[model samples]
Target: MTSKNLLTALLPLVSDLSRELPERERYRRLLEAMRALLPCDAAALLRLDGEWLVPLAVDGLSDDTLGRRFKVSEHPRFEVLLRSPEPTRFASDSALPDPYDGLIEGFHHHLEVHDCLGCPLFIDERPWGLLTLDALDPLRFDSIELDALQAFASLAAATVNVADRIERLALRAEDEHQRAEVYRQASGQQSKELIGQSKPHKRLVEEINLVGGSDLTVLITGQTGVGKELVAQAIHAASPRAHKPMISLNCAALPDALVESELFGHVRGAFTGALSDRRGKFELADGGTLFLDEVGELSLTVQAKLLRVLQSGQLQRLGSDQEHQVDVRLIAATNRDLAEEVRSGRYRADFYHRLSVYPLQVPPLRERGKDVLLLSGYFLEQNRSHMGLGSLRLSADAQAALLAYDWPGNVRELEHLIGRSALKALGQHRERPRILTLSAADLDLPSPSTAQENPASQLQTASSVAVAVGDLRQATDRYQRQIIEACLTRHQQNWAGAARELGLDRANLSRLARRLGLK
Candidate 1:
């Protein structure tokens, strides 16, 4: 690359520093400029969050690449680049396994031998992240001028610094720093983040940011397995009370008798099972946020009690006359249509009104377009790490199957499918392969036509069994047994997948299976 061409690429980034651009766009243009100057097959800009290198933007890599988190310890090339002061280019035959193996866009094969070049971006003498370039040819950067690349690295650092400054100015400096620290801690613990680039996901994020700083009661409504709980975590993480506890309670997981006690605590003698005085989710989350999953499952009586606390900011423990004052920000999520429940007199209208003060509707997975590929990548990486595999990826046909099928069970279903597919695919090989590629056959998702036919086929089977069973109760039990058996067989006896397929909670499905003598 000529110095003149390098200057041309750097100039655009330098000018972009002053232009107000979205953080993702700025980094995207930076990678675009890098590729233009160096003429590499792929380039990525990653931010160092604790021990993980998170892709902020990418060019010439798969869309799912953005969702992956690369640990510096696992990738030797990344470790060397971060430790070095200047740009480092690995030799073509370098023994270090390429992290980008099977990840380059339009490349279906593992990158056995390829050129890799990277430079660490530093801000205020502290390493911020990395700028990396890769090429299919071995000597792509051998004749390239190192000084030009070094100069461009400095420009990249400036671009990142500008983006950080703009964001800090938008939010409180201390709060933003705290949030970043929380994210770093979460990264170190391998916490799953809400990862996506679709417009719907972006909109949901925007809404989270908009309402997160306040103490608004946010009601998140979505289909089951659509990640409503993750959304609640994100809101709490972004809130002013992030340093405090964010307690969670799943209303549906508990019985009606226990829901009230869980929400408002219970004295030692409150009920037969109440052995000791304990704090409730509200008191436990004092000065923080309280997330109620499946809030719609709460009975009308409990809903009225919950509304009183929301209105008065005080709660009385079960069997206790004294009321306890507590401050808590409420964030509730439900897959049910609470408004319909209220109309049906099953849910309290006033409590429903209070909870919907800020309603956020999480979009289902099918509407997210190609985001399935990105999510698949995230799950694949997780399974790869768990299985101690070099790399795990989806083939073109697997990607097509993921996109074609309607994600009736949403993100949870996708996550389970990917993990199952990876394990099944691995078992097919006598020896472990360096790159485990999941084909459409391994995924085992029904074709669009087959999926359409399944419901009708199931109904037909149910009708045939109804004639053999004498009573309505007997017929219902027989139908349920058949459906559960079919789902279990389809998912290879994976209870989680079977539960998701039947649109029932795993625990509930297990209980039903046991009752039906199928367990």
Candidate 2:
């Protein structure tokens, strides 16, 4: 390429700063332009993230290469590149192993690249990341133009800096808008207060109070419908950022494709149906709390990105190269056991460690003892007001029933039961009763013997049934069902406990139970 062509090529990259090009696309176009100027088989743009080099854009690498983290201490090549501001090229047969050994596209045989060149991208004399080019042919880049490479690296730094500034500005504006909205409805709040005087309940409240004041990431674990969200709300309400809005995103509610875009805002036309740029939940929760419900449902890919943001306080919007800074205290809740998920390879171990800086376990309603009645009264009153009734109360028998049965669905089930019983009692009244009374019949409480079966007895019953079965499959199925049933009973229907005893994670156990029609 002639000097005139190289200068002309540089103009487009400089012009890209003014245009609304997505960060990733701009980096890609820049790499492509550089590759065009200096011929190479593969090229990549990696960003410096703490002690790791995260690939931001790549033209000739495997898809998995983007997901992999390249640690500086482990990879001498990356460490060497980071040490110098000038361009560095290694001898084709250098003893040090290459980081991109089998990662380069169409070069899957694990054969070493013959030539390699890397230019450290610097912004304001500070090391940012690097641009790397590789070739299979030994003499491909033997006489590479170092001057042109350095010049292009300067332009790449500008591209990164420009992208970062633009994203931060736009996100700041969005954050301000959300903050304004949060302040307007300061008094209009949900039922975040925990309402129980039981020892377990009091201890949980104490835990919340202890952890709520700091910006530490919290992991709330419990069974399904155990009011994890309410705990998160209470924590946020008590935190320093309480005055700001608490943004929430349900990882289980989102599809895989939309998860990234929903957490990290996306640029216009980033994907199909993305008509305009949109701010993500993280950006909205910049100054406040972000409650990620059912966080265990997030894919590994999303988990990696989430961990990056938590560690660096930075995230690039989908399709846009600009990096946005956010200040958020995350409270993630999940019924599934994350430790088990990590062991099962469904969740990222590093992400799990990052999220569990302070763990809070929400006690189940069954363990809360009389707290069930307390929550029942709260929900009963709530339903009463909503139903336009003057007053409502649980009858003596209904109260006894509420206390007697183990609440399998936790507080949520009790709340629904009270509301339903209230309606039933009202329907049976001949006239408008000032005080609607819910009876044991109205509560529809199960028998104690049936609801609270002994695990040993349950296991024995299963063994008996299994022995009576004629077919091998039926007997095996019956035996497996019995073991699971006994484990669930032993643990008082806590899936986490049952999972631990059965050598399965809550997710896998739940799936198995569903297949067996246990639910």
TM-scores for the candidates:
0.83, 0.53
> Could you report the Cα RMSD, in angstroms, for every candidate shown?
11.9, 28.1
Colliding pairs, model 1? none
List candidate 1 segments past 4 Å from native: 171-174, 180-192, 446-519
Q: What are the runs in model 2 whose C-alpha is more than 4 Å off?
A: 1-187, 447-519
Tens digits of lDDT, candidate 1, 1-519? 666777788888989999999998898898888888888999999999778899889899887788788878888889999999999999899988888888888999888999999999999999999999999999778878888888999999999999999888875545745874675474455555789887768889889888988889999999999999999988888888877778899998999888888899989989898889998999999988899999988888888899999999999999999899999999999999999998998988899999999999998887676778888878887888888888888777777788777788999999999898899999999999888888889999865443324567867766777777767678878888876886676555868656755678899998998998897
Per-residue C-alpha lDDT of model 2 across residues 1-519, encoded as one tens digit per residue: 478978987988888989997776888898888888888878999888556686777777654345344557767888889998799899988876676655456643444546888999887888989999988887898667888898889999999988877765854423433443354358463324576765668789778867877789999999898999989988886677877878989999889999999999899999999999999999999999999999999999999999899999999999999999999999999999999999999989999999999999988776666667657755765675566654455555566677667677998887788777788778888887654666788888864443234568766666677678767667767677767897688577878756754668789999989878797
> How much lDDT does each candidate structure score?
0.85, 0.78
TM-score of 2: 0.53
